[model samples]
Target: MTEPATRVIVVTVFVIGALTGCSRRDRGQREVIQNKGSDTLVNVAQAWAEKYKEVDPTVAVAVTGGGSGTGISALL
Candidate 1:
């Protein structure tokens, strides 16, 4: 093929490949859910967060425990 034709084909292929491989995730909409709860419930909360993230990678779940008051404050 001619150099011009070859270059056009190469450019087209590259553009198509790049577009197809791109992921459309809205970083601005990404959120991290922070939870603070009783130490006993902390494990359960963490497990729920992990499962949630598996289904929604854009949502981050973080869990911390400092007692009942802390849990309530976290929600507020």
Candidate 2:
């Protein structure tokens, strides 16, 4: 993989890991990670979410795509 892509992935994973440690689920709530955008990434995102469930079933990652613009808008 390219250096930039690897860097981005690493950063994303780090963020996710950090989030896992501090979640609302322990207080009787669901832990959710919203992943939006990138049609090309939707497949991989879904796969990652499914596999992550095995690794950490307490957290749920909801992945969806509606073009990059849609995602950015949603974030706003």
- Structure candidate 1, residue pairs in collision: none
Return the TM-score for candidate 1, rounded to 2 decimals. Answer: 0.57
lDDT of 1 by residue, 1-76 (tens): 9999999999999999989958766768777778877988999999999999889988899899889988888778
Instruction: Give the per-residue lDDT of model 2 (tens digit) for 1-76.
Output: 9999999999999999988968444576778899998898899999999999999998999999888997898889
User: RMSD in angstroms, candidate 2?
Assistant: 11.0
Worst 10 residues of 2 by lDDT: 21-30
- Considering every candidate listed, which one attains the maximal TM-score? 2
Error of 2 at 73 (Å): 1.0
lDDT against the true structure, per candidate, is 0.88, 0.90
